[model samples]
Target: MTRPKSTSAHVQPTLAQLRALIAVVDAGGFGEAAAELNVSQSSLSEAVGKLEDLTGRPLLRRSARGTVPTPAGLRAVGHARSAVQAAGDVLLAAQDDSQLSGVLRVSSFRSGATYLLPPVLVAFRQQHPAVTVKLLDGDRAGAGEQLLRSGQADLALIEGVSAVDLSLTPLLMDDYLFIAPESRGTQPVTVQELAESPLLLSPRGDACFQRIETYLGRLGIDTSSATEFEQDSVTLGMVRHGLGITLMPRLALLPVPDGLVLLPLPEPLSRPLAVATLPWRARLPLIQAFTAALVASLGSASGQTTPLALPVWNQSPKLEPEARG
Candidate 1:
């Protein structure tokens, strides 16, 4: 395993250098970062060179194949971004003694922004009136994970596993409902029936939708008969409008938009809504509080347990050093 940039050297990175490094990594090359940063490639290279000297390791590999982060480079970027963010938080902490005002950036997918954010943001604003919060809905595959990893977002309310290394807090248990017009009839629909029926559902790329697809796949039913739409709201509208029947999260029914009935799933099909961030960022008060609030909100929504059961531990054989030795 490659180690991240060392902080033991006590060589402080300036804000300018931190930004330059993040930009280079995000843009995938210094030349591109220079264009985005409005600086010459030579200037960007100089900054990276200085960063390499400071960190005592090369951060990027460049060639006609384009740029790739060296093992050290990936670690350096993660640490560099974390360090820069910590510095900003420190400054904010100091400022809070006089004025408790700052920007809180958050990112999430549509379902999160729609069903999850309204109450959380409302409550957070009520508590932190001085702090300004901005929420952006993102594409699950690319932009959502990018915002968190790039240090562009303070807290990210993502679904799951865009990448493997993310440490996540289980936020809510979503009950999947098969929705149809009350006029459509009351009988429960099976996976096979829905596969062939006219289905109004969000695009395949949506996280919860993908989970439903996996469930369908598990049942060995092809989703070729499904008709894709923009989002749950629109799809729900179509269902209400009598266009087709579809699956939607139970929580997504807030306000219980009329003209439709939510049918129960034939099997247990639960999806998790989660809060995610770097594991090392676990201790920050903002992160801690945000996580607590989400879990609490989920509990309140469920009306059963305040927190989920104590997290289960893995039951596996421990690796023995003697086996390797």
Candidate 2:
């Protein structure tokens, strides 16, 4: 008589099989689950079939409404989700703790990407040669929102005044300066003094535009006649050509362009610059590593005397005047 074959060998389900069951249960259909997993429907079905065979029970009840997890499948799917997440954590731990070896997606505004992130990225890359940093540029608010809410970015560099719910760490302060033609007088420019020139301001709805308006409003300067330009390059170009003077952040004036002079605004208004990330995301080893590297880079660049502590949202430490510049 032939001996009964052993069934123990087939009991263990593969990670892919577990993932397929979870995706089908979560997504409610084979096609939707396949799309979400970036695999073909047939392949997804095959994976779930293998999982069912391993357990010797049908994991999903297919119907016109959608695929629903059976009783055993319901319990198994719950465990599978946790298992998949655990597997991911293990992989991330291996990459982050042992050797950095994955893509780190960073989002920032144009100026931050250009002037601020280069040194930080360079230093991080030197330390974690296997990790690749992908930078995505957008407006400050947009980038911060994407990074914090949408989970599209691993980290973000954004202006400090963000409305979203996120964990923000102050990196530095960027001083707002007066940009004028070289022909303008050398003395520090007052709001009233600059108001006398043809003022090239950012468009009304812009954050920078609103900031300048508030600053000038306090000085009783009428800016109704200011020419508004949408792009920074255009505003700076106009200033370069003697069309008007404009208020610009020092970060935007790195390697100040030819034919332009940067003078300190009276009383020197500055905006705080911060790194933003989700609170949960901050706990990840990769994000923590990147944040440390970034802080070190910024600290080195700014020449801070003491060790830096991460600041809470809207609460930034005062840096020395030279550091702000």
Candidate 3:
């Protein structure tokens, strides 16, 4: 009788080995891939060698120019990339199922973070107590730019301006309100009337100032004579003391001072507020959770009768006042 044919056991490649192969292929050299993987060149080479031995094929060819993947290596690297991404997904899912502990870095302008984020953050903390939310505040343009360029912040809340290569989700449209001393009466202020009033305006280079100028320019109103203040608080204080009338977004009027009167602009104009993130970063569960919390908080704050939809530009929802005794 003929003996049964002998067969060798199949060898499986470890995740580290697959990662080494992929890194080498992408980085185009052993040295760079080793540095990226935070492993010694010898260790990375050994891992790739083991993978090659298991598969019985040469994966990479070293040259004077750089490392190049063999035909088989190219195919293996493709599948290796998918495997590595799958492994990361598994880890992220495990973290989410657990306590979800980690810092969620957020970038936003001072007004957005201070006036808008507090209530949302309070609710977020209650849901994920183990997660810490860190805030980095700056100007709107700078904050959003830094978040994308540096990859330091997971999310950014900023004005709805078109940022190339970044994804923007409009959350709300805040109307510009005419704030005047209570003595001016509660009557709605017309844009034409604003042309004659002594306006306390933000500095010329400010985004708010630019928006206001653009809006007024469309209405044939000239505000070149308006006095410029560097700080919103200073401008608001001047309005409080009856210095001059000022225009501010409704969201910025949080904790509206006792004696100031807020009137809707005769021709209503609103600035869009949006949340931004890199396309890749948006897929993270932690980022998704924070964004969901923000959306829910906005819905609760608005008390709208209709269902809230994203990119809600036309709905001017009323913001509930902070509790006062």
Report the number of the highest-TM-score candidate: 1
Candidate 1 lDDT over 230-306, as tens digits, reads 75678878888888888776656655667777666777787665777766665565666566767776676545474
Q: Give the Å error, residue 105, model 1.
A: 2.3
lDDT of 2 by residue, 1-325 (tens): 1224337873677889988887888799999999998999999999988787777778899788799988888889767865665577566765545477777888887778888788888888888889899987656445555544544466888776554678877777777878788777566566567658888987786557777888888888878999998778888888888888898777776656677777778866777777888765666677788888777777775566422422112211111133243
lDDT against the true structure, per candidate, is 0.70, 0.74, 0.75
> Can you give the TM-score per candidate against the true fold?
0.69, 0.66, 0.64
Ranking by lDDT: 3, 2, 1
TM-score of 1: 0.69
Identify the candidate with maximal lDDT: 3
Descending-TM-score candidate ranking: 1, 2, 3
Q: Residue 154 in candidate 2 has what lDDT? A: 67
Clashing pairs in 1: none
* Model 3 agreement with the true structure over 132-158: per-residue lDDT tens digits: 999876564455656554444668887
At residue 258, candidate 2 shows an lDDT of: 72
